[model samples]
Target: MTIIITGGAGFIGSNFIFYMMKKYPDYRIICLDKLTYAGNLSTLAPVMGKPNFRFVKMDICDREAVYGLFEEKNPDVVVNFAAESHVDRSILNPEIFLETNIIGTSVLMDACRKYGIGRYHQVSTDEVYGDLPL
Candidate 1:
């Protein structure tokens, strides 16, 4: 099965990728990350060369690009870990947050509807819950 993991460069998302890779070696994993301040490409370095894994540097807010990805990947599942931060501060200026969190999520779901996906899981607010152990 192919699983498209959005925001896979962040700590929580990267951890999920590692866990999934280990748990399902046969699965095709497509990681889409915009590499914002919260996202670090180096975090996924360990799995970069894996045959079953692919990393795309793309923003979830970019509808055209996201749809292109959906076309290319034909993912069975889309786990949306993509989000924006500085919640309290950003609430004062929520454009970026809304674009990434709300609008971007809509784009993903629309693509899922057009392209067909078995599941779409949204994993959110690791920041609110506090950090998880690396």
Candidate 2:
């Protein structure tokens, strides 16, 4: 199985990549990350040389690039963790957050539909659920 993981260089995404690689040694893992401030390539260094691991540096909002990748990779599943996640930054410049978080997600979904990809998983934080009682 080939899985494309957007934002795979970020904290949670990177951890997921490591876990998947370890658990499914025969599966192909493609990491698509824009290398934003929160995305550290070094975090994925451990799996860099693995035969089943591949990395692509590109933004999820780039429709053409995303489509091309989907066409070439023919991934069975896409796990999206891409977003402008800093609360302060989102408060200061909401447009960027909207573009990345909303538009980027739309582009990814469109590609999935166009290519007939079966699974598209979104990894989101609890913040979207608003404040909750513990």
Candidate 3:
């Protein structure tokens, strides 16, 4: 089955891909990433062109591109990891966070709902739970 992993270039998402690759070598992995500041392609360089692994660079907030990918790839599952993950960065530019984290997620969710996708996974931060006491 094909699984689309958004932001698969980022830390947690990339690691999850590695884990899944090892666990289920038979499955195909489609990594969809925008390569935002927190996303580093280098993290996924090791598995860039495996027979079961593929990468696509696109912003989740872009409705046409997102829908196009869904149509073209026809992924069986979607794991959304695209977001403004850093709280410090969000503090500096709240607009970016709002646009990426809130609006982008909304767009992705809408696309998933419309497409009748099999599964949708949202990657969220513990930072939203509030800072840890020092």
Candidate 4:
């Protein structure tokens, strides 16, 4: 199976890629990322040279680029971990968050529909729950 993992350079996303690659050696994994503050390519260095692993630098908010990728790769699954984090950043610039979190997600979903991708998953942040009592 070919899976597209958005924000694969981020912490959790990277870990998921590592786990999936190890678990499914034959699966092709494509990583789409904008290389934002939360994303660092070096974090994925371990799998960078793997034949089944591919990293594409692209923003999820760009519909055309996203659609083009879907057409080219024909992914079977898309896992979205792309979103603006940090509560303070959200408070300071909510527009950016909306553009990425909502608009970007829509673009991915739309591409999924257009390309006939059957599975799509979103990895949400813990910030929604905020601090919790022990």
In candidate 1, what are the lDDT values of residues 25-100, reduced to their tens digit?
9999999999998999999999999999999999998999999999987899999999887668576876877778
- Per-model lDDT: 0.90, 0.91, 0.85, 0.92
Better of 1 and 4 by TM-score: 4
Question: Could you tell me which residue pairs clash in candidate 1?
Answer: none
Candidate 4, which segments miss by more than 4 Å at Cα? 126-134
Once superposed on the true structure, which residue ranges of model 3 sit more than 4 Å away at CA?
126-134
Q: Which prediction has more favorable lDDT, 1 or 2? A: 2
RMSD of each: 4.6, 2.0, 2.6, 2.7
Q: How far off is model 2, as Cα RMSD?
A: 2.0
Model 3 weakest 10-residue run by lDDT: 124-133
Could you give candidate 4's per-residue lDDT for residues 8-117 as a string of tens digits? 99999999999999999999999999999999999999999999999999999999999999999999999999888887998888888878888898899899999999
Report the CA-based lDDT of candidate 4 relative to the real structure. 0.92
- Rank by lDDT (best first): 4, 2, 1, 3
lDDT of 3 by residue, 7-69 (tens): 899999999999999999998999989998889999998899799999999888889999998
Clashes of each: 0, 0, 0, 0
TM-score-wise, the better of 2 and 3 is 2
Estimate, for each residue in 1-134, the C-alpha lDDT of model 2 and write its tens digit. Answer: 99999999999999999999989999999999999998999999999999899999999999999999999999999999987788888778889877778888899999999999999998764333345788
Question: Distance from true position, residue 117, model 1, in Å?
Answer: 0.7
Residue pairs clashing in model 3 are none
What value does the lDDT take at residue 41 in candidate 3? Answer: 95
